[model samples]
Target: MQRMGGASASLVLFLLSFSAPAAPIPAGFVSWDVTFPGNSGSFDITNQTGPNASTFPDTTFPITTTLHLSGLGLTVHFANGSTVVEPSSYFTLSADGESFNGSPIAIGGTNPLPTSATLTGTFSPVFITLNNGTTQTILSSFSATISPSAGTTLADGDFAIINATTTTVTGTPEPGTWFLTVAGFGTLLGWRKKGLATFRNLLERKGAL
Candidate 1:
């Protein structure tokens, strides 16, 4: 009985180790280097410091092919000289998996982010490779300032201080992951207990325990 109790305790300790909190996501660029379906070459935006329109370097595509902007890193400043750096982890790839991941932040004076043809998210026009193998922006009737700061009025104001590169944000697993892990550990403990019981029974029959 005592041996079985010790075995059970050991199993509990092992499981507890895996349940410990994961480390926080590191601050800075997380890479997202991938090619889209229609691209002729690998669309490299490897180290974008999210601002303006980042485009693929070296690789040339047909003029009609539109290779718009990629990456998202924003810096918001306040009149008081305070700054907020948007973490890269806050974004995931767009649903189509081809556009920049867009997220909005609330700013001064009852500022709610606008959704219409406005400037709060995208900093520049989408770039298209021209038929001559040169790039041009399809200027939208509406574009907003990426540089937003505090004291900027809620109306006609830019809140994003700087548009910068985007990266992946690593985070901890959910409770469901822990639950599955514990279940696996329970199976291991059960097998160990069964093995111990069988050993004990054999020893008793041999008059050894």
Candidate 2:
């Protein structure tokens, strides 16, 4: 019994050592950078300071179609009066297997984040490409490096946001169908109970449980 207890205590200690702290809320966009294979095209992102649309300008990102983005790499820069941050990666988007990515803040806000700290998302849109080796496209998820831009001077009412998905499909279910179905179910139960009660009463007159 002594050996077993000692072994159990040792195992518990080992588990505690390997456990990690909870991840923090992806807070401000102090800085970041994302790089990706060339050929990624222009992608747009939304930026607003508060809940309104006038805080920052809506902008489209630059692209590098070469195998590698060289010295002129993309970046997002952020700074409060006393602090600054930037991204080293790009945010990405895709459809039917094709992709596009960006390395700057997708959306910007003015007040939610301090100039010293801002949130940023970089992306790389993924798509299949053929360079004479084959004649087809197989959309696959590809990494798009993203981060903050170089020389960013964030303002008090400036921020960034990423619209996670752009795909919109619309269809309506049989409108009122579910509500009617639920009502039908209650009707069914009520009728079933009434029939059972009637049968029970008749049985009691004759003889049944």
Residue 193 lDDT (model 1): 79
For model 1, residues 70-180, the per-residue Cα lDDT tens digits are 334434444445555555444555543333443444433543332211122332334433343443333322222332233342223222222222222122334664565
**How high is the CA lDDT of each candidate model?**
0.37, 0.30
CA lDDT, candidate 1, residue 196? 84
Tens-digit lDDT string for candidate 2 (60-129): 2211111111112233232433323333334343231222244434223441222223333332232211
TM-score list, all predictions: 0.25, 0.18
Find the 10 residues in a row with the least total lDDT in model 2: 62-71
Which runs in model 1 stand beyond 4 Å of their true positions? 1-63, 66-71, 107-128, 131-209
The regions of model 2 sitting more than 4 angstroms off are: 1-172
What value does the lDDT take at residue 199 in candidate 2?
A: 83
